[model samples]
Target: MRQEKKSEKQEEKNKECLADLHTTDPRDDKERIKQTKGGLLEDSSNWILKHDDFRRWRNNDEARLL
Candidate 1:
């Protein structure tokens, strides 16, 4: 039940993010660049690369292929 509530909140947040992207002004190139460099896109990718689970999985895969 708690997990479902968290999942619903995340889904709503994602929807709002997508809606905001569509509403952003196209003329604001500087704002777009700032967002691209410093926003969720970069943060999420960085998190994945640095995450412990990903690191362990990557190392295990590399060792397995040897």
Candidate 2:
């Protein structure tokens, strides 16, 4: 029940995000970037590369993606 509500809320939010995609203004993007200045997310790919599963995959010769 709780999960359903969360899923519905997320679906609504996704719709809202797409609703603006077709009509985004450059000024809005500039302002959004300015608002997030100095707080933008940094790369986290290193964390994934260091995980044990990733290490195993990197070392394995027969672990094809398919």
Clashes of 1: 0
Name the lDDT value of residue 11 in candidate 2: 99
Q: What TM-score would each prediction reach against the true structure?
A: 0.35, 0.34
Error of 2 at 27 (Å): 17
Model 2: lDDT to the true structure: 0.83
Q: Which ten residues in a row have the lowest lDDT in candidate 1?
A: 38-47
lDDT of 2 by residue, 1-66 (tens): 999999999999999989867777888887899698843466646789889999999888888665
Q: Pick the candidate with the highest TM-score.
A: 1
Model 1 alpha-carbon drift over 4 Å, by segment: 23-66
| lDDT at position 60, candidate 2 | 89
